[model samples]
Target: MPHPAAEHSAQETVPQAAPPPAPLPAPAPSLYDPPELNPGAWQRAGRRLLAKTIAEFAYEEILVPVRRPTTASSPVTDAPVHRAAAHENPSDPYAEYTLALDAPGERGAPREPGAPTGGGTLSGPGTPSVHGAPDRHGGATGSVGTGALPSRDGAGEPRDRAERPHLSFRARRSAYGHWEVEPDSLLLVEDGAAPAPFTDPLGFLTRARTVLGLDGATLGHLVRELSATLAADARLEHTGLPGSALAELDYAHLEGHQTGHPWIVLNKGRMGFSASDAARWAPEGRTEARLPWIAVRSALATYRGVPGLDTAEQLYARELDAPVRESFDAALRDRGLEPTAYLYLPVHPWQWDGTVLPLFAASVAAQDIVPLPSDGDHRLPQQSIRTFLNVSRPERHTVKLPLSILNTLVWRGLPTRRTVAAPAVTAWVHGLRDADPFLSEECRVVLLGEVASVAVEHPLYDGLDEVPYQYKELLGAIWREPLGSRLDAGERARTLASLIHVDPAGRAFVAELVRRSGLAPEVWLRRLFSALLPPLLRFLYRYGTVFSPHGENAIVVFDEQDVPVRLAVKDFVDDVNLSAQALPEHEGMPEDVRRVLLTESPDFLPQFIHSGLFVGVFRYLAPLFREQLGVDDAVFWSLVRSEVLTHQARFPELKERYELFDLLTPRIDRLCLNRNRLHLDGYRDRSERPHAAVHGTVPNPLHAL
Candidate 1:
């Protein structure tokens, strides 16, 4: 979806009389020969994904690698020493590691010294090989290492070097004990063979399958997901714009350029989508279409909205133009149906064709559900895949429809109960923000409320709690406030996730913004933290409320000069959680909201910030700033800690609350996103949604400060 921060030009939002309905665009020719599936693009995508897999898998403790000792050996006094010996210095945080894996196939014979390995090239000392494209930050992709021995015994002798294959890379352990592996430095050495560049993610997964504890079935599905992800990555790489160009686009258009979730290894594992389906519907597809509306019998459908949208009529009056509403009413009348007997909502074309029609065929045949023509407003799909932005009418509410594809961790479907209670939840949260001076005046945080919703429960699955959760969430739509309408004239918005994005040329997007802002990197970053943290902290410490402000949910609003000024958050019904302790602040929470919203202990509530923002987004962003802006990762984290402390100092009265929801504990549980896919959930269908698995504890950087 559009970066939550994108704003519309003044001319685009100017008032105009409603015109004739625009005709739907004709279907394009089939994508039989997709151009982005080239070998070069695929290989580059594979290398980058492989590096991510190794780093994330290692962090989750799913595939542990032994740290290789960095012993210095002089070239003149002895033979040429391993370059990793530089890591022996106390000031050097980098370390060498080796991961041994079961050999996949017959080992090849040893090749001639200094000969080119089949897969990729090896670099000499001081000059590391960069695999794919030219990286602006020099080593952003990674730096190749000298051909170091894979492993050694206690006696310093090579241990069965010819027996199995092993991967060696240089990495640095940062705050929270996070491993930052250099992608270009990855080298794979086989039995008595030369070290080749490890560029094949699929091969790496297969070779390390046993080590990763993947079962046969899980491994097969995992491969398909990873492959699909790689294809999407390749497409992004093929069509990606420079960071400078991306910065100039409006929020709705910018969403099309974003790479998917930063932490999930299979971020784009859109399981239910075919190649063609993805090309037309995926966020990266960047295509806009008019969504077809459907009428569900009032008996089977439930509508909820905030105060002004108390009834469906009010929402339809604002959302649908006069002619469109007349046409929809005519459609219902033609079927001998009373318009008042049905609830109208938009359905994603893909969802209508692939899910609703087939699964709810009986309802369609019985006239319980009827399809209507599009409202004629063309919307672009946002990064969320299911949510759509109204490019045709910037002032219109963004529509979020239930898309039954399995992506990232769960089915991309709205939970039935959550959907029905969405507006109530929004009303309660909006009440909290509006009543608090700190949130309303000081921070001025934009809470893009889910103002209205229509939930259509399945005829059979809605009652079957034992069935997979997706079935209960088959058809629904949520109307959210448009970010464009919420922004000031000179301001633009971008998702917090966009801050960590790196373009195909390895140029960091943040760097571009920093350069444009004409401010020091540190200053720009401090402004960012200042904008994001205060509001989130106020909600957590004083109100016992938290939103999962991970990259996608938390948006950074920038001023004319591109400096971050405020935060904008969305996805309230799904992401907002409260404390189980029942604070006074929650006294005003509506019954429907209290029942539907999940609650965690005060101690675990901070994890929504720790895991969602710190570990999830900033963990990756810290390393990027260090490499791209010459800022130290330690300093990068220190700025974050300072922001928290500053907020805490601003509210001395909430000292007890700060202690109760401690964010500065020495260590926090390592919420493993990748592990959930590999071990915990593993493509299994369940009655409930899956959650991130906690593998171990990680050092909290804020604690060090």
Candidate 2:
């Protein structure tokens, strides 16, 4: 079969004359109504989000729910009983918990003197009341659960049914003190009233605002973000395919099916995107778009690339065809400007019209920034809304552009300093892998380098001190090495995030892959760990470096039979971090790379893997595996712990490094993702991007193993 790029190029070469412009279509009688917004879809999305809200909030110690004694009877009379585990072992991780909501304008029940005021006292068996003291058996263990609930009204009498609303559900505390709440098990009971399924995320948030410590302003913005997220979730639910079908998709198409960041409750809170914008540009939109190019004057634009792609011309030569280059030059020459005086880069259509035209009007008027027609390659947005994969030419570089919308946590924009230093950072990280025998030969880990970048500085914003970080990151483009060109023959790649994805029918993508591989679930899981952990472990212990191997940033490569084989990682400049203490491995690092990569102390350096992969990705994956594949959560965690130990044993000579960058510590700092948005950042614009909130420590499962 002819290559797709060849077909595209041949078609472009034979193009004759431009067609005449056509009139705009007539307006429809009614506005488009999205099918995904039906009540059924919303309720499903809401129930999931509500469960996530409760789980994440409880995990972060923001809303501590009191543990309730589990009885054989269902919490809700009509609702089906859901148990995390089938057997009722005394040491079983699952437990029942309840959170009470006071009536509007009424204060919570009075607390005993010296007891905590908000929730209550932690007095439940096997539930952790204090930080870093989780049960060794992979459950919350403590005799004293301080979180006590109020069953009575403020007038010291039992409140009416409607006046006393409380939520009850069964949840299991997994590794890293993670909470996995059974969404179907959640119920809202009002004293004398019959219990009903709790499916309203907004109502839950509104009712528990005081308990959650959310101020009015933050609560208002949070509600908006949550609603936006639910809408996106509904769309995914409406269109989601079964795992069997998803397993057959290519990397680019598979990305559209993924539910966003697993750890974030409001994962799709694209603050600046309208419904139309989302349909046109969101990853789940699954529409291919040709991004229009822009020419920024040399004075304001800076280009950076690795050794072979040292010049803008070199990058353009590889990224744009001759015809596209000539057309760009013709556009500049027609305006009486030299093409050499400008740097050409693609701009997202929405960003071009919404952000650039409005904010950088002065530059456009002065012809310092001139818009050019698209290079004519159709690209699909990946999980990261701002990144695009060129479907027209799969071998071409994937482009990451600045998008001034808030999602997950920060504005999805490339920072000026990091954008300019991307190539340098990539080169340094790639150099480390290339020089190491294990990474280069044995493991064969693929580092998808950000080979080139064009940083366009906003004239006024660049000069201003303490300007909003989003303004400083207004316009930039990073060209990353494509995944298609890096994989071995018969090897396919999927984002690590996809493994945790559960199809609307409750089938896990991992289970599908495992079944197709013809391997026992445990064997497939071991293969997954073996493929993922070694490279990451080497980077932290041997090289004193770590990449945030979070779901979105890491890609797992599978062989023809669907067995995981190797790892591919991207987003070098933003997600990579290094050790604060100087090591021999740092000797080859360039000054620019050193300045760009953030450094942490040796003690905290491992958090990138501990939090990013173990907690961020695997925390959720473990539960899904247990539920769908019947792999015990403890066994799943043990597999992960064994991988780390195996890697450590393989590098006995670097035993000292292992101690410095310890992964088997008794406790690890709890990095809170949802808490950052709810309590810390809360839609507020700051000069710098916000970091994850560090709450109390969580017991490390690896230590127990």
lDDT of 1 at 606: 91
Tens digit of lDDT per residue, candidate 2, span 1-705? 789999888878965789978988998788757789998889988888888888877776666665554676643221112222211121356777777665554433333223332333332233222212232223432221122354444455654434556788888766666777889999887656788888999888777665555667777888898888999999999999999999999999999999998878889989999987888889999999999999999999999999999999999999999999999999999999999999999998888887899999999999999999999999999989999999999999999998999999999888888999999988888888998999999999999999899998888998887888889988989999999999889999999999999999888888899999999999999999999999999989999999999999999999999999999998857888889899999997889988878888888888889888998888888877888889987798789889998988888999999899998998787777876676557778899877776654677878875
- Candidate 1 Cα RMSD (Å): 15.9
* lDDT per residue as tens, model 1, 1-705: 455445445435769899989999999877576688999888888888888888877665555555665574411111223323322221247766777664443122223323322222233312212112132113221112112223442233445545557787888767665678888889988757788898888888776664455667777999999999999999998899999999999898988998889888999989999998999999999999899999999999999999999999999999999999999999999989999999999999889999999999999999999999999999999999999999999999999999999999999998889998989989888888899998999899999999999999888999997999989889989999999888888999999889988998999999999999999999999999999999999999999999999999899999999999999999967988889897988786778788998888787789889989998899889888888998887688889999999999999999999999999997676677876677667899999887666544566778875
Who wins the lDDT comparison?
2
Note the Cα lDDT for every prediction shown.
0.81, 0.82
Question: Over 4 Å off in model 2, which ranges?
Answer: 1-29, 72-93, 106-147, 151-163
TM-scores for every predicted model: 0.86, 0.88
Candidate 1: which pairs clash? Answer: 1-382, 1-383, 1-384, 5-493, 6-251
Show where candidate 1 strays beyond 4 Å.
1-31, 72-92, 104-159
